[model samples]
Target: MSALQAVAKTSAPTPEYYFQEARAFFDAFKASQAIISYRKSLLMTPAAPQALNNLRLLEQSIGRMPDGVKSATRACVLEPGNTALQHGLTDALLSAGEIEHGQARNFWRHLKPEILIIRQGLPEEWNGGPCRDGQSLLICHEQGIGDEIRFASCIPDIQKRFGGPVILESDKRLATLFARSFPGLTVVEKVQRSDSNPPTAQYRPLVEEHGIGRYIMLADLQSFVRPSLEAFPRTAGYLTPDVTETRHWKDHFRATGKQPAVGLSWRSGMRRAGARHNYPELQDIVPFLKGADFLPVCLQYDMSSSERTAIQKASTKQLYIPAGIDQRNELDRVAAMIAALDLVISPNTSVLMIAGAVATPSIGLHSERGATFLGAKTDPWFPEECSLIKSGDGSWSALINEAIPYLTRMLSKGGRLK
Candidate 1:
């Protein structure tokens, strides 16, 4: 038997064996497997804070965050003197969309005064701006590319506030895109630079030397002011697909003569843990599309040759438009095509985020645990028009079955279609 199966067949399972398996799965980014193994380890021995913390990390990674305050409460109950857990619970509660309360005060009581003193040094404004006149503002991008895109909208707002040019330090791949998207803003790739004259010790110091008195982390822009979905709602003709590249797709759809077309994006981040939460093999969705009069448009990034072939064969006669990763304009084209489609169905991924941003009627398939606490019908991040189809038991087939009627109802609405 394989090593994993062999390990699973242990004569008498030990805590170490389960913990090791859980670690392996977590390292592989197989979140679901890690969660299962960790739960098994916990059952073997409860009151394990390490396992609980790991599980919480996995949950956050998969976008299913419990109210930090609630988690902190449980952690406090388990170990009253665990100050670290209490502080973590406060941070978690704040991140999960809760305002500060007496619970925060209680939790803060356990934290060191020095830590709070240092935190007080930072500016209170979310943008960290409205700095001294003529001072350059350094904005650092954090987290994933999708996050960068989501917060990119804030640049114009910041520019309006800070009369001086804004310097955007971000991932190299995004530098060019940002520069092109936002003219007059200095977009630089995050890189190590050697210099003379009291040379910089770190990247942040370099910004200070460049007269960037105000520093703002990109992810924190949301805290400044909530963005309205209607201002950037998905319009039917928002983005136009490239005729030279998408002619085949256009022709294939045209041949069907007014038939319903649907876009599909099944896989997400390849990291094993991300895959477990967002990845449902293409074959799993094939059975659901069997009798539908819809064309399958692939929007996944970095698809392998075998995966491509599988999707093509499984598509039967439906048109399959292969999108390239290198094409900078591909995402816009995909968004345009998604706009034209009868509906877009996807798991939590960049494509779903984009679809939601554009106001496309989408069915977001999420893990049952993720859906239960996050919400049931609509996502707070997206407009109310966008529907959420969550799994009750985290079963792929069941979720898809539940989504069909929802898609049908959306189609019947006679909304704008390109």
Candidate 2:
């Protein structure tokens, strides 16, 4: 064959080639590379539905909700009949704080394994027409402890909108706290095992005995009530801690010589999908503990006796944990202890939400991923008392070092930002 003929026979790489490479990168956990490959594929074939959908998944996983929404919209437009694609678009929209878009209705359908019903699908109300006043409603659980708390912020709004007997199933840890917080609502404790479905015993009797028929996923209230930024009430928190327990902890800590007290929670229990980037190791926070002069209290859940010792050994500071309080199982007590602290420093987990909700000064260490930001640095659900440290594209080591001065100032103010 002639050299010219041989050269003409050579072909360029197709968009499908790049798309497959992107998928490989995604499976390998090379998020940056996967994104690059997906973009490259799209550049070659702009109408590629799979590429757009996967890109949306990647973006949303990493907390880039706005970009995720854009990609999801494109993919949905290309494949209108695709329920998966439609659900992806809806999920991205909700995560991006588009609460007013009416996407929360079908949201539970998109959960992993894509199941939201407890035993069977309960009759849905809000999606149809004007919900009658005082109708019985069963609100079921979804996701983790932190999400449950974050979603509960809308319960107050739900109460105002619907004059019904509302039965809410919660994590056992949060049951006491939720019952105390919302007076009229019936709160039931249902411990959901990751390996199994939500326990029926925890909710069925209360639901049936109370004559509750219509239901909604607790988070679904986001669209009906907290649909706009303005709808979020400026309050300390919806979950109220036991004032007596709060006082007890405050006195207990005071007898330990009453220094500027700061509560610390470094991690969450579950292995969230593609979103575990910023929780620091116990040893990583040693620098924050060094010379801060404030007493460091352990707010982290499920700490072993060894890990507790490790915390003090790592920070070279004494760690204070109240007697008879289980940080994980007793979330209500955890809230009381959090209230007793002058400040709480944690990753964006349930403890952090507890701090913010209780009006305690908190420094939430975050990597800029979450719908809670509502397209801004601060979470609207939290009061000004809870300040968020927004970090991006950096190691937790660097993020903590950067926060040292701010931490010093906050302590100097005796844990008040003002």
Candidate 3:
């Protein structure tokens, strides 16, 4: 070996240097680069559990489930008792279709409990339990609104198996629609972010007053309810919007019955690091507004004036927003509006969840490989009406291009795509 080459080898950077490089790449929204740098660091130092865990999150977010599972499994092995790592592994397993394994259920035990409840309610429930009849099951609140709706897919299956009165703690925004849709569930209008600092003081009374004792986080029900692909109900949609409200929105759109009504959501409710990959800019969807076969309606909340003006400039006709409907707070009306539309188009946001729940024909543009996929090619929750275009490497433009055929089919005279 040359003397200069040996000198360069001796000055090679440390694993910690590569680790911090990965974190910076992720924070800058370069997910694929982050994954590569993380792998490089982990190769240099096998004991780096944080690097492994972070890599797993990036891989899974971009639909690389196999890589995600590998990284998560290693992280769990390195730190077996770490709640967050265990949770990460469980989610990786779930997304990789390893449902009945040791770590899939109650993984959120690592997260804070929303509220403490007395043990007297129903003590027999296991890590995974059999259906209990005539008992009360309190479905505790956790995560964002989108997650709540996605997990609610299990509600019907659980109800069928356990003939029990289910009490669901929901975001105040979702309470009305959830109540109307489930009919049987006692809906407590409230919001709680995991077992974290968020308080549930306003809705705790309903649990106590009803003598409800047993509580399960929403996602935990999956271990029993959807343990396998075949277990998911073959239903078009589960949530029922108010009939009159749906009719009202349908008529509002039908007035311009020349073109099909399409609801468009381009962003998430909250933005965070690496979130830009899951959404499109106002300019990105302007082409959709130019489509001749559909009338685009704005379903995006917290939209800026610049985006609104951009939409106005792009479309031959001005883009429409459903009047008097608060897209953020009035979720019941939002559900009805989604139901009324001939088609709904959005990124991997709550709009897709609501559209799926209401049985509306929808095309979802997603980059994140959410556990709701359950390792399937399409969404298992609402397979009949919801079609997902996943840009595995965070290419939203490519995903939008992928939706052309779906649009062509759904907009044709004889095709329902349902």
Candidate 3, position 215, lDDT = 70
Error of 2 at 217 (Å): 1.7
TM-scores for candidates 1 onward, in order: 0.64, 0.80, 0.85
The residue-by-residue lDDT of candidate 2 on 251-317, one tens digit each, is 9888888587788878876656644454676676778788478878878667678888886677668
Residues 183-249, model 3: lDDT tens digits:
6888886543243354323435555676654677776777777878898877678898989999998
Top candidate on lDDT is 3
Q: Which candidate should be chosen as best, given TM-score against the real structure? A: 3
Candidate 2: RMSD to truth: 5.9
For model 2, the stretches where C-alpha displacement exceeds 4 angstroms are 1-34, 41-54, 57-65, 75-88, 95-97, 102-111, 127-134, 191-207, 272-278, 304-313, 385-392
With a 3 Å backbone cut-off (N, CA, C), the pairs that clash in candidate 3 are 112-195, 113-195
lDDT scores in order: 0.56, 0.73, 0.74
Q: Give the candidates in order of TM-score, highest first.
A: 3, 2, 1
Relative to the true structure, candidate 2 reaches a TM of 0.80
